[model samples]
Target: MAKGKGKTKGNGRSKQSPQNPPPPSQCETLEEDEIIRCGEPAADGPRCKVHQAQYRTLYAKYKAAGKVVDETKAGMEMPSKEHIAQYSNLHSTLEKARRIRKYLEAIRVEKAGRDMHQKRFFAKADDGHKIRLKVLEKQMSAAVEILDAVQARAFDLHMADDPAREWVKNFQAAPLSTNDEEFFSAINSLESETDPQRDIMKQQRVAAAATTNDDTMDADLIDIEMRAKKASLLYVFEFVTSEEATLQCMREFLGPENANIGAKSSLSYHTLCQYYRRIVMHDPVLSLKAINKRRMHVQFEVLMDKRMDFGLLLWKDSIIEAMAITRSKAGTAANVGDPKNRFKVLGGWVFNTPHSGTMSNETWGTLLETLAPIEANIENRFVRLCNTFDDLITYLSFGALGLFPPPRFCSKTDAQGRDAVAPRNHLSLCGCSVNYNFLYLGHHPLRDEAGPQGASYGLKWRNGLTYLELFEMSPMHLQMHSYPDSGQDLIYFQVVLYSDTDSKDKFECFGSGNEALPAIQTRTFEGPPASVTNLPSGRGEWEVQLSASDLLFGTKQPEPGYLTLLTRPGSSGWFFHFKKMPVKYFVILDTVPHRHHSILAKHVAWTALCTHGFGEGEYSNRKYARASDVMFQKRAEELLSWKPKGSWTATKMGD
Candidate 1:
């Protein structure tokens, strides 16, 4: 009976029950006017999936437009005219604020460029230019203030929670302080609405996707290739000898024509070696022995009673050679034998060396003391000096050094004795170069023909004074000089010291009691009753005195120390360090103009003094010096000894 009841599967159709619902037929979406319904077949909801998605999009649009949606009819209400107007006004206000901020940023960037130009060129802004800049800054400030006010108003009206709104709220609440740091920090902390959006996560994902396995493998292969190249016998040989590399570098420096000339003559290698020797000799630190050998000549006076210094001799020779070259090119009949020509030649050398170019004021004074008296004919000597100086400048421009003469020096007397005007195409040397004029040293201030109009320049020199001399002079005195154009003088001395070992502290009472401190100390001395003394020279000399206690470490004897003499004439000054200070008294003599020559000379001299002992002293006995040399030699030999059939060995080379 049960089997008969189960077998009643007539037509294979199920009844429309609660569990087995009937399939949907038509979509339940209404039109915009809510007059017609969408009659599309529904796949999963009251409407078809496509119609359901469109309904959700409309709902979102209505919500964003601040309008209510009628869910029963699936329709959105139209916005009022007043609401549309308000939305437009808000959008326009935000856009205006953003534009104002952008314009202000552009102005700031332009102002920064102008400021940099002024600083770089040492150019002062005119009154009108300064006023215009101030006006621009004020206008930008006003625009920013207006934008901030507008943003505040928008926040108040809308009461919306956004980055911009929140920033405005915090900005208004922040306290105004006189402290610039606090005020700036508060402003920086506030987020800007117009800032560019940064999608860091998306960027990181994109970068990761771009770096494929092939790219990684390529980078690894490149690294492997480089290592293999470095380990090759050919590379090892090139690195060790470097003859071809040196020749190539010299060829690059000398130009192709010059290099080819040397190569044709079979002197390329010899020329390169000569160049290497000259460079090594010119080196201030490495060529201490060479400098010392020259110094011995000075002590012995091997050439004459008053032979020129090594640099001066080299300069004289170079000038003579330059003159010869000039004469050959011009086909001039004049010889160096004539008295006038001889005087001119001497004057040229005098003007150019130890005074012209970048020579130091101190060196200039020393040179003048020796050569000024040689000009016996005072009347015509000045004229001859000018003529020769002009000639030397011309030679330098076209010959060695390739210096550009100033405009004032370009004016000359023609063969007919008439004033000859030359083209003023070249830029004059700056104030720094002209400052070294020998005529400005008070001896002949009126003779400064190269000096630029309305440009003020001065020079100062300080002698290397010893510790004993410094100790003897007490209660240091400084003469207060008034500079109408420049700012007040900031004169102070700084003493810096470092201990060789940690056990001996260079500084005492660095921190609180029993605190371990670093073995370095710096002390600045300024004002009266501390570093200066009353021992004044007749020429308004300001004396600076330092006692043994002031400079020394406790009761320790006088050890090797460097003394830096810094004498500034106009705001900025340069210092030269003396390894051994032995002058009786420190002298700050005011003079006029010089440039880079003396600074370089002093640097070289100091380097020579500091490094000369290392070659023959106990320090050279250290293991690193000899051991490193042997290790390098052995490594080179091993690399060179490599063969196609032999196994590598790590045998040490004997000393």
Candidate 2:
């Protein structure tokens, strides 16, 4: 009976294993609290369990004793000496470590609190600007908390129909009240939920583009290299040097906006990007090799001809450079009733004789005498300043290479030319690839005059998208604004782009002009891209050459004409007697197709793996600054040779 009792207790009653002890009997009890306090196993527990809680409390005490967990969760997690030993032997004295940890924990707590406080303060103070935690952890925590609350409340917001959506439906800032007397207030910009349908469509399109073939990219590059020189010849410009590195600057030049460019350029980065994306999604093939890089630094110098090997001499060299001429009344010269300062344009600069010919002091003097009568005060003065005008001078000759022009389409014809392009009609498109590009330098501008009659040049000019009329030997009348404006100042100028030829060609003016004679210049001084000369190089006779400033045979006329004048000096004087003769103006007089019109039309075209405009039929159409910046990420040409073998480099998480 005794043996049976022991067997039942050990096997049936408890089933105790060799490494285990028998279960506690009903009559027996344990002091779990005492067991933990003694640094022993829990009185009763499932092996891995810490049921007593005393050990846990004691275990963390090491770090607490070290003074690590005085403030933050992170502080509490700081390992004790025992933990450090886990990594590798620290071999430091325990007491010293404890002291150091204590100090570190104090700093951590103080910094966390300070950061949190700063975030709230900044958020409240800023007028709608978003503040991100640059280096403060406490601030980020506070911001995260606020974001959480905002998001929760945001979802509960009602639809436009709901009455609870009072603020959103009636979306208006409260008027200043006499009692409240509040001067200003800011409100959050409400955003509606995105359409799932649109999201799905976007995903499908992206997937489709990913799978599409991209043979065009290779063809385009190969064609560009082989034909780069040929196109320059048609414009009478010789192919000079080429630089691949210069073409890469488009990365920074990127912005999100497709350049809606209103008469007044008042738009934020976000808005600009939105607008740009609607039309311009991608960049085009650009080459910036020909432009002088140091021209801006060396405003005056002399250069030698590469072909002729002669000194490009300088005779005063006052080439008319009319880019950013400030128009001014010298202080309210106009509207004497309210005489305020007026900033106006002086006009584009001319090289030698303004056109391409030699203008001696005497011949130029007579010409200026004729021009001054029809000129504004500023322009007349500007013209007189050109007594020593000459193109013989160049910065390149005098060891001053100016800032190179931004990457531009250093175009050359393919085997075929723009004219050689096959018409799209009859379901067969032209194999000839002809392209035209313009750098619409989007400069910020402001108009001070409340209701003045005068007009500003860059402030208001035709920004065409299509190459409907790229070549400009003829005079085409263009209104100052995109959409025609009514009333007052009418602009008319006799534009002799260059005497390339064809006196029979008449300029058909486009955009706002009420006069019966809608045409402007009576010439089509062809400044076609180098593409014209890049025809098939059959045998030795077909070498490719292209240039913007290429000199053609038998004609001293500049292919693009002289430094053409969009306007002369910002003159305050006004003359109703319209006349723009002798003073040649080079206005971009064609409407180019927007990105949307082109991109969507070629729905089946496969885009290359390359970013930006390296892909085929690439549309640089962007709407915001951020989007444009993002598009520029993979702009390298070597993308063709790259493989996706490695993962993205690790980046710091956004605080």
Candidate 3:
């Protein structure tokens, strides 16, 4: 074997191999000097004959100076696998630090002692250093204890015991006249459940703050004082900014993906509206709900809602719960079948493959352009489109029916060329979740109907269709081939149909026209959910409310460390366990989203290479997952090893 491309990734060597050559068709935010691109028009091209000497001179000059040097020299550079790995590790550490900092700031946890932690601590005491240091140490001690069994406060190297151990003493709750239990409860929950030392400190303060004559502390007055003293406008500002940053991250990362191209514009525009709509909320960062109607396009809506952990006080709590579900048995599986058919035909939305986060906007755009309904290049584009269609269906479910009132403002009637989100009635009510448009076919009666007669018509529509009969349907022969063999091959699918309302029997639906279609084994547990009363129906939408847990995490048991959360947010403040991140960080992600898997590949690979005790600065191709492709297979678990693919030498998992 030619020592495949990954073998020499990080030995401080660089060669032009297809795998490691300049990343193709993707957008990257990089320091100007660190990028290397291939194939551009001479004038537009980098390092071409016309600009070679100048390019070399500029590069050499920049390198000698040791800075980003310039910003205009475009395209990403190729680094030795070692360099990439090292940089990735640094980034991961910084990210964790950032997350921790945000958590502290959210809860008013800051460094107490002289310049110890950053100024972002909980409260400012006259004995500031002592009080803050104690709090920091207490939290650190708790975390370190979880890392092992030792409950010793001195378990951490950074957190040393100070003579002033009594400082982390006063987290408390005063009565609120507003009776907004949520806000008050949120504060008390964290305060009461903290370490005993912290609790004891609080009690001592309460006794001191108490009036000797009254014998009761004026908690309300004291609480108001604390709010005024501890409240930060900058914190609120950054919260909104971070939300926008996150939305932009998804838009720039996931929007270009093939998996999201289905209601491409709808999702994007909806999210855009949300972003602008929230431009001036609570403290004015985002409360601008009225956006220009024209700007709210379908594709833009795709970026709107994401993780609700944004401004939450219990950010760690929510994610920890989600982590449990993801790490549990049911989160992992190998169900690589046709994704689109899996959602529509099989009526299930579970993923089974590790994502390779490849963050390439240009490449995904090329793919999106390729998938466009042009008269010429339909076949080539549809192949990739069909394979990733399951992800698209998931998007429709979470974004369309899962949220209400539309993600954005779209009041105009139908037009000639412009496209928007389908009328809500066009949505699908699958076994449990709601979807839009049948993923398997474009054919439907009058575009929207949930009535029994419409259901009967739907049966008739597919009854004689040949494409419905096969387990595997080729995208190329979609309309050309007739029923039976025309239905393609559906042997890989498994579909179930739940009623609009409840009942004991959940009816099983298949790709019409044949028995060969994959069978979605019906369940005795989940009765028919979407039951209908009217035999004739019009365009009325369906909505389903999901628990925070359901969207935040997946089920546990039967499969440990297996999570299949993968959906695009369709509205504001949306939070669904997303697919395409690592098993360690996030449980839900694309089995083969977009090119959605690309983000997973890049980030996970980045984290693994940088963290996990890997050698100094070595990265592997295996660490870099591509959102455009599904990469899980035999020995796939080995990819979890911390070292770069080229340098790793360890016993694989599940051996």
Candidate 4:
């Protein structure tokens, strides 16, 4: 019996040994994959050692929340109340962020639409419109700030493995919901218990409870509160610089006498300076100098290097003195009702004319007599006092000598000088490349009342015969000739057609003969001077050339016979008037060898050609119309290559 018992005990020991172990107990705790239970051996509770500790933690959370967790029935897979709360909070935050983001996006779309509409129609928004837009912009900025904070909070609370936390992770990875209906639908589904289709909503009532809690805190006011809290130095700066604040301060500084000065009223720089000294400089929180220094330091960090001792901080008196100097430099005399007083207040130093004392009484009287009409029309008395009348006469004389005449077109002729008739229209004529160079001299006959009526000298004045006579003469010969005896001094001017041809022929022609041409036929003057030897010659000459294409067919065509008047002194009065003459016959010569001359010619030509015609009911051909001489000259000068005021090397060497 002892031997039989020993064999049984050996078999039992063998069954319990490692190689032949009995069935092990499995943990009832769920795995991270929820569907799979923990396969490790059960320890303290119905879970592995790790999950047993988790269940204790969860049970403790329930106890803290005043809920009894039956320790016997508590499962390790059940989430703690704290985790559930955190998950709810995270979901609420993410939803709030999404709503705020969508709201901001809607605001952006609206603003963009407004901007696009305004741009398309060239419409300007009124003050009320502008204010509304600014308010919306501030709201957007505030919304963005709130959204950022909410997203940060969501990220912090989104560490759990709950559905809410999972939703937050997906929200972070996905783009903000742009569709309003979709976003609202999602929120509604999450909040309502009636929706059984959503797996996340079916899990628990935590999200719904969180949604109810969110209603108590107005999300709309969150941005406003955040904006109020973030009012810092930058906000203070902006407030001080605001138009209303600046105007209010100005009004106060000006005292009760200037209280009527509204926003639209012009404020003088001196007044602004006074306000700055009295209010801004003395303010406890802000200093202009300090602000400027800080701004500079922020912009250029190298300026703040320890080794560099930049004397950015200056004495208050020095700053005040600098401001005073700026105010003085920028000062302008107030409008005076009295003309003489206005002139005296605004006039600079004046010097007497070179012939002031030397001229005869009669000559000076004639000059002054001639200037009476000019001075009477001048609005600025200071200009009249500054020898502006003399300057006017001198400028008109010089400009007339340099005036470029308008182009005049002629029928294209074959190699044998036979006229070739082609279909003629503005486009067809302007497109023709064939062109000829000719000198044009314009003359206005002196009135019979002023001088003896001279004979026509065998020239037909109606057929532009005088122009033909001038065209036949070489440029050198024309340059040597004097002014026409019968011509008015003010109306006489000369122009030369610019050409690149160096062939023996002085009149260079451009393009092939087969091109379409204008219909106008011209004939040179078929008369002669009574005595060619006695004709006026050897007068000062200045040549101006115009391209036919630019004068007639450019973006802005000069009006036919459009005459510009000289209202201002030192104006390009004659040039402006000459360029708009009805004469035709000119074309562009692109292959010209002298590029600079060609460019200068085109620049001057275009400047005159592009002058805006007087508006409807305005007299463009009036004798005293206003013309911008400075504008014309400025345009011409701009075409030339830019040159430094002084040699760069010499400037660097302090020469």
Pairs of residues at least 3 apart in sequence or in different chains that clash in candidate 1: 358-597, 435-593, 435-594, 436-593, 436-594, 475-532, 475-533, 476-532, 476-533, 477-533
Q: How many angstroms is residue 367 displaced in model 1 relative to the true structure, after the best TM-score fit?
A: 24
TM-score of each: 0.15, 0.16, 0.19, 0.17
How would you order the candidates by lDDT, starting with the best? 4, 1, 3, 2
Top candidate on lDDT is 4
Question: Across residues 282-330, which tens digit of lDDT does each residue of candidate 4 receive?
Answer: 2211221222231211111111111111111111112222233333544
Candidate 2 residue runs with Cα over 4 Å from true position: 1-16, 19-655
Worst 10 residues of 1 by lDDT: 425-434
lDDT at residue 474 of model 1 (Cα atoms): 12
Among all windows of 10 consecutive residues in model 2, the one with the lowest summed lDDT is 281-290
Write one digit per residue (lDDT tens) for candidate 1, span 1-655: 6665754366544655798776667766553223566566877566667655543443343233222111311332222334433553555655654555555554444444344324322235688657756755665565445444544444344435433344333323531212222433433342221133222432333334333231231222222222332333222122113445445544555556562433322232322222222222232111222222311111110111122322333333233323333335452213422323211111121111211233222222223332333321121111112222232222222211111222222233335542211111110000001111111122222223211222122222233211211112111111111123111111111112222222334322212232212112222222112223542222222243222223323332221111211222331221111111111111111111132222222222222222322122222223323433343344334333422233233332123
Please give the clash total of every predicted structure, in order: 10, 79, 111, 16
Candidate 2 vs candidate 4, lDDT winner:
4
Task: Give the C-alpha lDDT of model 2.
Answer: 0.23
Say which prediction, candidate 2 or candidate 4, comes out ahead on TM-score.
4
**Highest-scoring model, TM-score:** 3
Estimate candidate 2's RMSD in Å.
31.4
In terms of lDDT, model 3 sits at: 0.26
